[model samples]
Target: MARMLGCSSSYLHKKMKSIQISARKRFTPISDANLEEHVRRLHNQFPRSGSEMMRAYLHAEGIVVQRRRVRETLNRIDPAAAAQRWSQTVARRMYHVPFPNSLWHIDGHMRLIRWGFVTHAGIDGNTRLITYINCSTNNKALTVLSYLFGPPVGTGYPPESDRTTEGRILLWLF
Candidate 1:
């Protein structure tokens, strides 16, 4: 049979098993009217809730419902609300750099400043390479300048432009 069907024997066996299993299973259809009433009640209580939240609320109320059904019901009942919720999602911005050494991103991370350590790092935007990185006791102008200048000064190749956060020290140095 597998040779005639041009498929592996294991694949044919798996397909036959799945068909038999499905044939033995009985499916009970859910009434849309009853489910829609429950969904409407929940939606009235929480107008801002999405499909996943509606499913959770239904589960809490001892009503088991699928997420897709909840979404379809919600969309039919309130298209405007669904559209508003969809629009609330944030869009990602694309980052583009022409060439390596054209632009360098520099930043000072103060996450460890409470423990008396500050981190400064730089990366070539185009190649995504770590040009320089250092941790120091203070994020002073000199320390930041040294971090920015160390790699270029050593290699005798500086970036065309340096991008950094709007810090007073960085602004003053520029």
Candidate 2:
């Protein structure tokens, strides 16, 4: 209703509250206690009853209620059951690493679908930390090497003595 009237919901709620202030609209502490008890009793009777079903049950008893509120109450009573309700199917294959930095997962993602630069990142398997990250104009081996080593035409060289002065390319055995 507030959106339809081009105003914020909080503003509408405040206006309605101001209007009701004169009439003294009340939902007391006792009302909350009763509601908690009602929700608990209903849940105990029908352990498997979802929000919609619980709302239907209340309506049949001449009590009007919102399904969301009922659902929240049910979840609060049993967090485990609430979690179980939303659990997805198990993965066919699960991956595990014994120690940090033992394995690294490298992936490339395009900025856009057709003609966008790609961002490459290496993530440690166990620690799940980002080992290296860079964006390239194109997803090429040279671009990846530029990130790992240094730029092709740089004044200074890398400090690592083991690095070859000659053109040493990446060779994948597997």
Candidate 3:
């Protein structure tokens, strides 16, 4: 056969050895009983864990399992939970702003606060344009209010809505 294929017998033998070694290394599916029990227990305990997380949990517990098999087991054991998880993964909230000035997002970034700088910025929700941006030493109510009012006063129009989670600053605005 090696002579017919124009290769040395030694090379053919080496190839055959390599093929056998790879066949040994290939994953063989284990019985699902132990895996399903672990998956069910972990799923019951965590409830919100996805297949990858369940696999990680199993790996941490010294049990090896495939993600697809975990998901299949989860679907079989708890169909409603599986469907809910699928829906949550697929569902997305749509963010829509009618016009450039219809909504403005105001936020203060404190990442640089260790260096005594806070970045206050506003962006137009629809256009994603930076309407106002300022780096100040403080994020006090006065400073944040200035950021909120400065641009609109300059442009002679206020946005219909200003979205911010800073409660104190929001109180000052209203």
Candidate 4:
């Protein structure tokens, strides 16, 4: 094309560079003061909200914007509020234990079902054996402690529970 126009290749390249338009030089579509303040308020209300959530918020507020536009506007509002991208440089190590009973994992099932009672259980991290299991009307610290190392249980004396008993058990067992 430049040859057809009878211009030198270097001169044509220089002119093209001088006339080239860039997105950065384009005017922003959203420059409203209320939009910025609204973005700030949304971030404060939902600190963990991302672009998708903000888009929903804007839609609910009768404002519609593309996700990219929402993100750009948000970044303009608060750099800290924007989603940060991070990559894991160091790979995670697989779990390893030399012997059984070396580690135990305690987990609580708040409810088996919507109407079910709470249950707590522990397992040997290495052996996969159930170390302890207990069901309580309410999942509480004292109930969990009694299940682990509380006083012996019987009809006369109900199982006595622990305070920070779970953490101590984990520390020693693991």
Candidate 5:
């Protein structure tokens, strides 16, 4: 090999040693058949590394080459850009139930009506049931009681005469 390169054996060996590479090392620039292949693999693996890192890897493996030369070699062999791309996809599944009353979500919303606070209540869509609703004049004990018990079955909306006994009882209970 030294004679082929037009140098004495000792001089070639000395040169190799000065570069920290053994003359018998398997990797080389244009020879040994697999050098380009190895560099190609490295280029694919470290797509984002600058030329310096590739040079360092080769240097650490005892291959003798300048950092600039290594970068040029890599560019000539692998024409792809240094930047690499990646992505992720996510999917959400819908939930369905077979029957009504299987689930019910209740909530309260307050609105200002003619007299005072009115609470609006409702069930979630999954239940498929109309929400029970009512408007109240006041949130005081008496007003809430009347809304719930409904004017004692049929006292005709509580005449002034009938207002005292039953209404007073319901208000006291609350």
Candidate 6:
């Protein structure tokens, strides 16, 4: 303890600060070539992060650094501006559309049967509702589109906007 050592607490703290400053001053600034290599490796490993994130990642690897320092280093080493350009591409890839019907998706299924007809179905990409389904050998796009908008065999078509009210006809068909 400071009292046992016959020294004030402030004196101990001051000595600690001096030692820390001296140690820090001894650490050489990362070389331009080394910084570039490290940044390149970090970018390749984590392409989505900006300079700030990369700096934090470096610190986690026990390298002492600041965000602004990392940004400057990155700009100098990769003067061609490769990471920034590639980041825009990655940004575009990260976004996912939230709704169905925003995009209609249709796929066919093969069944074990004499005819093995195509099972065509249309889905609203946003709502994930089965807009229509048809098991036919024809599998014509026009035919399926027509049936979807056409009047039901007996009952009327389900509401276009209402997602909760299941179509009685579809339940029966399945």
Each prediction's TM-score versus the true structure: 0.47, 0.34, 0.52, 0.35, 0.27, 0.35
* Best-matching candidate per lDDT: 1
On TM-score, the leading prediction is 3
What digit string (tens of lDDT, one per residue) describes model 4 on residues 1-174? 579989997887777779993334433355567677777888889876777889889778877666787787778776664535213235789977556655556667875646668888866666676767777787776676566554234212112212244655434542
Give the poorly placed runs of model 6, Cα more than 4 Å off. 1-9, 16-28, 76-174
CA-RMSD of model 4: 21.3
The 10-residue segment of model 5 with minimum total lDDT is: 153-162
Clashing pairs in 5: none
Candidate numbers sorted by lDDT from highest down: 1, 3, 4, 2, 6, 5
**156: Cα error in model 5, Å:** 99
Clashing pairs in 4: 145-162, 146-161
What is the C-alpha lDDT profile of model 5 across 1-174, one tens digit per residue?
A: 899999998998899899998656554454423545656777778866566787667657666555566666676775465322112224567866455434333333445755475763323245455434456554454554445344233322212111334345443564
Runs in model 4 deviating more than 4 A are: 1-90, 113-116, 150-165, 168-174
126: Cα error in model 3, Å: 1.6
**lDDT at residue 62 of model 2 (Cα atoms):** 61
lDDT of 2 by residue, 42-113 (tens): 889988777788877767766665566677777888878778766743657877777764555555677653
Which lDDT tens digits does candidate 3 get at residues 1-174?
A: 789999998898799897874334333356798788878888889998887888889888877656788889888888998898888876568999887677667788999999999998877788888888899999787887776767855443343555455534555555
Q: What lDDT does each candidate get?
A: 0.77, 0.62, 0.76, 0.64, 0.52, 0.61
Question: Which one wins by lDDT: 3 or 6?
Answer: 3
Candidate 6, 19-87: lDDT as tens digits: 784334533378767877888898778866667788778877777665677787767656556465555
Superposition TM-score, candidate 6 onto the true structure: 0.35
